[model samples]
Structure formats: structure tokens, C-alpha cells
Target: MAFVLTSILGNDEAIKILSYKWIWSEEFLNKIPLYLLDDLLRHYNRSTMEEHKLLEILAIIKKDFQKSSENERFRD
Candidate 1:
């Protein structure tokens, strides 16, 4: 997962995703590998790393969060 995350952080998809906001919370940011966030803007658009990048990332994360929430909800 770390490798995949590292690779994606610079990929087109990552760029596309980060090209809008920057709101990386300490919690979510913690889960990412230490190196993933350092040069994110190099791969992603500068717009994505704005302070609001955290918010934009939150938006994108919500989708995955929703999916996992459903699975967890059904687990028990």
C-alpha cells in the first residue's frame, strides 16, 4: 500500500485529484507515508496544495470513507 500510495502521489490520477484543494488533517495525513506529502505539488497541480487542499482531499476521501463505512456497517 505504501508503494502504491507513493506511486500514485505523483501519477496523473493523483495530479487530477490534488489539482483542487488542500486540507490534509493530521489524522489522514498521518496514515500516508512520510514521503507522500512532501513533494505532492510537483506531481499534482499547485492549486491542489493550497491551504484548502486539505478540504479538497477531504472531499475525495469522503467517497472512500463512505464505501468503507458501508462495509463496516454490514460487517457485524
Candidate 2:
């Protein structure tokens, strides 16, 4: 899974996979390590393409992570 996430940017099919809502779900996102997510964010930010879906996916992923962390903090 991490391999797919990390290499997705290199290929069209993989990049297309990012459009699916399941890819941004908490369960799938939680499966990915923070380091990898950070790396993905960096790559997404560095992208030269104008207003790509990857950016949108990144935003959704970040929002989900922020909400998840806030919920955890509230629980604590």
C-alpha cells in the first residue's frame, strides 16, 4: 500500500487511483505512515502542474488527519 502511495505520482494509472474516495478514507489513510504522508504532501506541494486532483486529494487527506488528531486530543 505504501509502495503504491509513494509511487503513484510516477504513473497515470496510480495518479488516477488517487481520485477514489476510498483512498482518502480514515482506514486507508491511517494505514499510511506519517513520514510517508509528509513526503507525499511535500511532493504534491512541489508539483508544477496547475490545480491537479492530487492537490484536492491532499487537502482532503490533511483535513481528515487534522480531524482525527483533534478527536484524539479531545479524548485525551
Best by lDDT: 2
Candidate topping TM-score: 2
1-76 per-residue lDDT for model 2 (tens digits): 3343455555664544444555656886775567655655566555632345445545655565444532232221
Candidate 1 residue lDDT tens string, 1-76: 2323335455664544333232134655565445445645453454344445444544555555544432232221
lDDT, each prediction: 0.44, 0.51
RMSD of each candidate relative to the true structure: 11.8, 12.7
